[model samples]
Target: MTVLDVTVPFSTQIREASQAQHTEAENSTFMSDLLSGRLGVSAFRRYTEQLWFVYRALEGVTDTLAGDPVAAPFLRPELFRTSALERDLDHLHEGADWRSALRPLPATETYAARVLEVANGWPGGYVAHHYTRYLGDLSGGQVIRGIAEKTWGFAHKGDGVRFYVFDGIANPAAFKREYRALLDAVPVDGPERLRIVDECRRAFALNTALFADLAEATR
Candidate 1:
C-alpha cells in the first residue's frame, strides 16, 4: 500500500488561492481607516459587537462536530474568542453589559449564517470557515489589537483589546505552524479541496462586505 504524501500543504494552497480576497479586505477603506488610526473607539465597538455574533455562530457548532476528523482538528479551544469579545465590549461600552449590544448588521448575520450552515453538516466546509476566521484572528488580528490599544490608550494593553489577545497560546508563530500542518494533513482532496478553497475566498469576500458596511455606517 502506498501511503499518500501531500507534498504541498493545503494551507498554502488556500492562502495563494484566496490572496486577492485577502488583499481586498486588508486594503479596504474600512480596514485602512481603522489601522491608520482614523476610526474612533465607537467604530471599534461596533466592530466588536458585530464580531460577537459571528464568533458565537462559529463556536456554537464546535461541540456537535467533535467526531469529525476534518472539522475536529480545527476546533481548537484556544481559538474561542466569545468571552474575550464580551470583555472588550464591556470595556468599550464602559461597564454596560454586552448583551444589549448584540446587534448584527445584515452582512454580519449573513456571514454568521453561512458559518452555521457548513458547521452543521459539511465537515470539510466547516474547516473552510474555521480556517478563515481563526487563522486570520491569530495573524492580522494582532495588528488591530495594537491599534485599539494605542488609539484608546488602553491601560496595560487592557480589557478594551482582549479579543486579540490569545493568552492560551504563548507563541503564535509556532502555533500557526502547527495549525498549517493540521491543514496539510486533513484527509480531503480533489474537488472537495477546491471547494474548500472557494469557500475560503467567499469567507474573505463576506469579510470585505462587512468592512464596507462598517465604513458606510460610520461615515
Candidate 2:
C-alpha cells in the first residue's frame, strides 16, 4: 500500500473529532454563535488574522529547516501563501475593535502550542515523508477544507474561512503523484521507514490531543 493509504485513516479520525468539537462549541459559546452569525465579515476577519500569524511563523520555521537538504524539500512553503488573505487579516487586526474583544480562551493557545511542540519532535525523514509524500497532495488541504466548511462555512462567510480555500485548485491527483515521487526518492531502509511512519502517527496523535485539550479547556 502507498504511504497515503496508511496515513489517511488517522487523518480522517482527526477531522471527524475536530468537526464534532466545533459542533459542540456552536451550541455552547455565545461568541462562537455570534461570529458564525456575522459570517463573511467579522468571523472571517478574525480567523484570517490568526491564520496569518500562524502561516508567518511556519514560513520562518520552514526556511530554517530548508538549509538541510534532507528536510528542505519537505518544507512546503508554497502551501502557506498569504498575499490574497493578508489584506483581510490586516484590516481586522488594525480596524476591528472586536479583534481584542474575543480572546481564544486559554485552551486554544495551549493546545496549539502543544501541537507545535509535538511536530518539532518528528525526524527530518518523517517530515519529508509526510509533507512531500502525503500532505503536499491535496489530502492535507482537503482536511483543512472539511474543517473550514464544517466550522466556519456553514455558520459564517467566505472571509472567515479563507484559509481553507487552496486557491481554487480542485485537482489533487497530480499533486498526489508528485508527493509519492518525493517519498520514493528518499533513500531509507525498512527500519528507517518504520521510524518515519511512527513519527507521522505521533504527529497525528499530538494533533488529536491538542483538539481534545482545547475542547476540555473551553468546557
Candidate 3:
C-alpha cells in the first residue's frame, strides 16, 4: 500500500509563501527607528495617521463584504481599528483638528486604493490584506505599543497606543488559532489559493513601500 502525504494547510502555505515579504515589511528602516526610540512622537503620529487611511479603506467595506462568503468568515467586529485609531489621533493631536491636517503619503494613497480595489473586486484578496494587518497588530504590534507607551509616557494601553489594544479579544492566542482555522477553511481551490498568497505578498510590499516613504519623510 502506498502512503499519501496530507496536503499542507492553506494557512501554513500562505504564511510560508509570504514570509520574505513579511520580513521585509517588519524590518523597514522606519519601523526599526521607531521601535528603537530613535524616532520621536512626531514620527509615530505620522505613521498612525497613515494607518487611519488604510484601516478606513479596509473597514469601509464591512457592510459590502459582510454577506460575502469568502470575506464574511473574517469579518470580526472586534478586529476593527478605525475607532481606536481615531481616539489615538485625538490624544496625539491634543484635541486639535487632525482631520483638516490629515494627509496620506503617496504610498499610503496607493495602499488604501489597492485595499479598496480588492475589497470591491475579490473577497479572497480582501481577506489577504485583512490577515496581514490585523494579525500583525495582534502579534508584533504589541511590541510597538509598549515602546510607544514607555517612550512617550502615555498611559498603559491608553489613548495613544490604543490602536494596538484589542479590548474585545480576551485571549489573543486562542483567537489567532481560530483565525488561522478560518484561513484553512477558506473556500478557494489551488489556483485561487495561489492568488491569495500573491495578494498577501502584495499587501506586505505596499506596507514596505509606506515605511520607505516614511523613512524618507522623517529623515
- Top TM-score model: 3
lDDT of 1 by residue, 1-219 (tens): 212225667888888888999999999999999999898988888888899999999898888999888899878899899999888888888787668646788899899999899888788888888888989999999899887877888865579888888999999999999999998888976678888888998999999999988999899
Give candidate 2 regions above 4 Å deviation.
Answer: 1-57, 81-137, 140-157, 168-170
Candidate 3's C-alpha runs over 4 A off are 1-6
CA error at residue 83 for candidate 1, angstroms:
0.6
Candidate 2 residues 1-219, lDDT tens each? 423334444334323433443344334443343334533334444444444433443454664465655556555544554553564454445555644554543444543453355345544433522442235225543443455567544323244445545554445566555645655555554455555555554444433443344334334
Report the error of model 2 at residue 12, Å: 16
Q: Candidate 3, 34: how far from true, in Å? A: 0.7
Give all TM-scores, in the order shown.
0.94, 0.53, 0.97
Best of the candidates, lDDT:
3
Candidate-wise lDDT, in order: 0.87, 0.45, 0.94
List the candidate numbers ranked by TM-score, top first: 3, 1, 2
Global fold similarity of model 3 (TM-score):
0.97
Of the pair 1 and 3, which is ahead by TM-score? Answer: 3
Put down candidate 3 lDDT per residue, 63-104, tens digits, no spaces. 999999999999999999999999999999999999998999
Give the per-residue Cα lDDT of candidate 3 at 45: 95
Q: Which stretches of candidate 1 lie over 4 Å from their true place?
A: 1-7
Worst 10 residues of 1 by lDDT: 1-10
